[model samples]
Target chain A: MKDPLILVIEDEESIRGMLRMALEIAGFECIEADNIQSGHTMIANKRPDLVLLDWMLPGGNGIELLRRLKREDSTKELPVIMLTAKTTEDNMVQGLEVGADDYVTKPFAPRELIARIKALLRRSPGVLQDERMQVGKLILDGESKRIFLGQEILEMGPTEFNLLHFFISHPERAFTRGQLLDRVWGANVYVEERTVDVHIRRLRMALQSASLDYSSIIETVRGTGYRFSSRSVVPAAERFEASGMHSAHWQ
Target chain B: MKDPLILVIEDEESIRGMLRMALEIAGFECIEADNIQSGHTMIANKRPDLVLLDWMLPGGNGIELLRRLKREDSTKELPVIMLTAKTTEDNMVQGLEVGADDYVTKPFAPRELIARIKALLRRSPGVLQDERMQVGKLILDGESKRIFLGQEILEMGPTEFNLLHFFISHPERAFTRGQLLDRVWGANVYVEERTVDVHIRRLRMALQSASLDYSSIIETVRGTGYRFSSRSVVPAAERFEASGMHSAHWQ
Candidate 1:
């Protein structure tokens, strides 16, 4: 297989050369850009597998470049790892909030840099060559952008499908509305959190058509946000086995 | 720095010896246990930085071992990685479901194993060395498992504390009920899925005592699950944002 491509956007010639050499040694094809303009141009033309973005650039700053990449439909899904000198918590939050997949501080070890790249690549959806995702009776085909519940295809809007896609891929963590917005909506756009509610409702309705137990599957966290659980709604038989028939485990 | 202590629980003598040598080379102090009973005792006494558990054992399975570790208060925080020959889909889900922080299929390279060990340690609360988790005014002490809103301490149960701990540790990204159960409850217990709902309610009540805006913090996904967010619940924000926003941007 051909080596995965990496786009490095940095102004410093020395740093750029160093990163190119390191990535090349690690079996990645390198595309270097001296500034944000060239970076965007390369991004538009080359569409590299991943982008190693510098936080600061001459005209459009890295944050601005990140915003534009996330805004556009074609590039929104591209994985980005920010390379920055700013290691403060606030800057980290802003970088993450802006949709950078992961970040590394300047003066990082080459080994650490390579490890992060490999980890990010492994986690990216593009790395999974499988065109379909299947769990239990549910199936999601990335190629067709279709979902199948058992044998029957389930029809859902783009938003609901994307929501389901995220949930299925990373199951078992409660996500707040803000997080959903940041991930699903992209970091650049500002939107109402409640809109998450409308889309969630639509997604559930779509799942219901397959006769699945959508209610118990997507559990409400009351004051928290939402979680998708494959746990049975009924307390498992084991609970009864553990708690003697006399004392009530439920208060 | 003193080497981080690691407990290796496996039946095979050769594998155990190999792991012991490799871990020592990787700057970790090692403790060995052949059976589940002995492993539990070693865990109680040593309180190792991490547990490398073999999935198949002569006396008991690794899933059960993980369950017992997570149930107890003292050892519950310990990170575990399962080493196994079984690479089936069901096994992966089951291992993860049973609270194995990570799993490595057998015949694995030592480097990959060590990398995973280091990665888990880095993410672990104790190992991360970050004492507090704070989102806005809400603060959680990882070492003490205490919640403080401003200056006042918030009262909570072990389960609620764990729930809050997981939520704060991973902000954003909605988790479903099954995932929460596997994570917070550990994989072995068969409690009512709705029990998560009850605990969430109790947690909210505790947060309310501090007069913190806990209500808006945990958002209900209606049919999906729960998420903890810092976003405001104002309806006007939703109307204004949703009108022009793309459906994908809900979080």
Candidate 2:
């Protein structure tokens, strides 16, 4: 709810300046990136609360940059609004599929773009928590945006981090992939259920790399999807023993 | 930007009173319905900008009314936040699955509920444009929230109105079921893609009932889902001739 700083990733100097002027007039602090590479670097260096990415950068297009950001653990959760041209609506859809949070077509009213920026920022993933969370050996420092297993840091994609953060927050309960998609990814997205599987796998992998056998905390419920339990995480043989008489049953 | 009137459909009088006080304190006008039957009526008559529904009611639960509202094109777009008790989390999932926009666990802080209400209203479907739109004989009056074909009014569920509204606004372009779900239902909802097919069928049926052959504008684009073309209303055989070969291809 604080005054948000916005990063403008537009290749065109005129568009970037235009956006900065508009955003500043609306009382938002703004930064600029003229190409995809700089945009990505700026995102890492500046840590802007939200990003306004232009779809057609010279060295790499906006979709490429968007995909990279979404793929990375560090920047995946950043709210990104792509600036697109009216004729390139297909590219806009592609950008959305690759995880651009929202988009504004070029030749759009500046008012409309600012409105979208405000809306996207209002419920951005950043607003959810700023606390340290722990489940057994795993510790998620929401304030610093880092995860640790015992002593080692568990590095993962932004989505993976978010998935782990959610699991740590709500342990001992099964979440269907749909529910995970709704909660961890935020309800506004239209991501595929398969994406949840990919992120879960990456999260477990991150945990495993940090500490062997640590990944067993994340359990797969046959018909129900995934769940995280902080109890005895010994792989398969002790699984039945770990899940005592009060067992989870799926219909 | 106007002061939002929120309807709290909670059965417990104590909780209801608590909510009214909290909402009123937050500058929201409040109304209440103690059960599902009256809840539905209040929604129809009162037209609150947002709804806070408690999952359990005496005769029929809140899911029943949520389903009924989502099924009707008239109330489907209404923003509903289910007031779920923490113990009945599964019921909360069911409420969300049935199309309640968001949910808050009961014994929730008044501040959290007010925040959810504010966030939901910030991007409610009601905040979109209010202008009458025309596509062929079909006239979509965004101001009155009605659809008309020739002289007769075409009544639709709120979702259908939104779908038709979207289609009329973005005509001649095919949209996948996922895209339709995101655009029409609002990006925040996690509705199944199959729901799009059901709504499209209903919208077409409503158009057909008002007039004999007016349903042809809502055409299925084979593998691509659907599109609204105001050019030709003729079904099937004339379809090939009507699509005189700036043809669409699906991979």
Candidate 3:
């Protein structure tokens, strides 16, 4: 691929110079703007791969530019990494909530800035899109945050929904409680790994009440973890196919 | 270092016979429990290195037994593998989410069962433990999900927390986005590699807000990924001590 073009939007000439030097050395092509107005124009004209946006621009801030870019369909997916000195929880959360892919504090190391830019530019667009999945009679629409068994909708908590989504997406793989905690509970949540068991039970109970034998669907992998198996819940004939077994007879 | 003892808990006489024979042949000492109640007794009495539990038993299901074991501190860490006819998503998820170490479906190849058991037993206990680390003024306590610069706590999102944890644990090692996602995010997650950038920036922002200047702490390995450097974040006097670079000097 040609060198990824990075658009730097900062009012400080020195910071911009540092960024340009670091980016060039890191083999990235770059363009510059002193404020959002020029930044907007540069983006429209140049269509750079990513924007290294300053949190505080000359006129309006980077957040404003981020909002505008996200609002417009053509630029909605343009990746932006905010350069800011703000590191408060509220500020960082707000920046991310506004769809800044990432943010670097001012006085950032050249290598850190370049790494952030490379990472943002390398991201695929589908990462932001909600997906829909179907397995047998079950349907999960991630965008809608809804699940269906055939035509009937299943009521489940958001956490349960996420857990189910993960399991379905990664079928047949067994995961430990610790792994489940990291994956389903989010990596840094610090909840007891056993919490996974409670949620699993809740999910299973929900499925059970819906008249599905949940155990068959979520087979227990003794001593290891759990797996989403198509065969366990199906009739014996169907199970053979689900497990990739050609012969039905085990004896 | 005696051969690991494996407890086989299955109601089927033939299956139990097969497991005992297979386990013995695999050089494992075997114990048998025909139901959940008996399995509990055997575990309490024998303290087998691993349990091969069946999903269905004579009196109660294996999940109930699992819940009881995991609830108790002494037996909570005991590795368990579930043997079941159930292979559907719900069943597998329930079993896994409920804390079965791993599971194998009925008519499972003896080799497959042995392999799963071996894998589960091979997992180090450290994987399940919450560890704490100190890097200069930075204190990361995994159990509490807290990071501190001196006495002040730094607030960050779950992803950022995990990224920092991974970086600190394996300091100075450059990790590609793909590797970061695998080690920090669970292996099965299909997130965009660029998402690592978002988390890395978030971590840096958290560190920076606390006057940590983590750019030095989390170094960018250009054309690669990221690293945590003791020298960058610590004062010159402390850097020598932190990195063990006491004799080296830059001209």
Candidate 4:
């Protein structure tokens, strides 16, 4: 798959530079614009996967652009994260009511920004494409909240399905039990990381019943966290080709 | 300085274990309490620098403990970060209204937790003592929003003052431009991370006029970000002694 493209629209050259560097390093293609005129043109032309928009911009107000984007069907569904210095609750509500998918205040940790971007991207149409995703003969029907192996349905809890869905959608990456809780269980839900281990066991058992061996697929990095691999497991040789999965071992 | 002690008030062993591992690795002392009864006792006896609280407990609700802590003069100023599975707006409002220093949703990245922990610790009474902080000859008065070298006030912009205040409160720490923006600028603002450099430069210039060569204090961490050091910087030994700052590189 091609790298996801993100549009960074801000008035500050230094901030734009920082975003460009950070986004590219995080494996996303970035296009920059310093003002609303260019921002609108870029959105209309490049059609980015997501936008990192500044609340205060030159030539136009960010909230106004957000309103326009939401008003027009062509851009309405585009995922956006408003970058603003405003920290008040009223400001956040206004931004959300105007249809921002997320909010990252000024001076945000690049990792936080990247996390929010990744989360928003996961929900974007380009990534979701459809409600169903297939890997090998295994199928995940998100719309129906069901997993299928060939024609047979796999019985699992909603949490297991959500966990599997997240893994499949974001394969070849390690997720800390914490990240799993945030991504699969929703950020605010206070489930234990061991709860992740329990669910992983259940998921593997369910997949095993369907003649799939998860012991190799959901590889656990000792003392670090868990990861989802698309490649065959059990042998050290196959692991070399799946190097990307190890990149996030710090998780 | 001794490592800050953090009390983990949570019931889940797995989550508590994760917090312990993460906290100890980050150079902080941690004490775990599974219930509010023990939690209150720990607070009274141990008097930790901060608290990583779980919203739900076996015997008492986390919010109840928060209210009780805030109401009492002894613990009222204690900084608490509520770990919750509750992400609803009303829930957050309630948590904040009850006086949680911050909030970290469940399934948080270890780095995110550490960041909030560090930020809250910086605000805790033991650290702040007063609205003022002293480092060498520099005096940062939070209430007045002013910095003084001995007796004279240093001239700077609001952003520069905020940046300096954060650096003073969190000395011997290296923070990336993104982290600086998040910490100093307020996370939601869409300012460029490089804007940090501009304010930093301005701050340095202002400090230099007071005969303080900030080039040594605000050391650049080649390919990483920036750090504010208390020790003299020309030698490699001081850098090793100042290593505590790197614990937050993951942020």
> Over the stretch A1-251, how does candidate 2's per-residue lDDT look in tens digits?
23588999887888888888999998898988888888888888988999998877799877888878877878866888888876554665466556676777887788888767765554454335567765545667654456667766666766787788788767789999999988887765788988888888888788875345578788899888999886646445445643453332111
TM-score for every candidate vs. truth? 0.31, 0.30, 0.31, 0.39
lDDT of 1 at A69: 89
What is the lDDT for A179 in model 3?
61
Using alpha carbons, what is the TM-score of model 1? 0.31
Interface RMSD of 2: 19.8
Ranked candidates (TM-score, high to low) = 4, 3, 1, 2
lDDT score for candidate 1 against the true structure:
0.71
Docking class of 4: incorrect
What does candidate 4's lDDT look like per residue over A1-251, in tens digits?
35589999998754675576557545578999999999999999999999999999878799999999999999998999999877888878999999999998865666678878878886765454235665555667765678777677888887788778777766655555666665565433445457789998888777654465544567664433676765544345544533444311211
Reproduced native contacts, each prediction? 0.00, 0.00, 0.00, 0.00
lDDT of 3 at B156: 79
Model 1 per-residue lDDT tens digits across residues B28-74: 88999998999989988877889999999878887888878766778
Which scores greater on lDDT, model 1 or model 3?
A: 3
Residue B234 Cα positional deviation in candidate 1, in Å, after optimal superposition = 44
Which candidate, 3 or 4, would have the higher lDDT against the true structure? 4
lDDT of 1 at A220: 49
Tens-place lDDT per residue, model 1, A122-241, is: 666555322465545566777678988767788889988878876665444455565565445543233556788888888877875446644355554443456654433324553344
TM-score of chain A of each: 0.51, 0.51, 0.51, 0.57
* Model 1, residue A31: C-alpha shift (Å): 15
CAPRI category for model 3: incorrect
Tens-digit lDDT track for model 2 on B1-251?
23478999887754675576557545577999998888888898989888888888887977888888899998878899887766576877777788989898755655577767767875755444455556545667766788778888887899888788777765566566755654455543445567789999999888865345678888776544787875456444545543443222111
Query: Model 4 compared with the native: what TM-score?
Result: 0.39
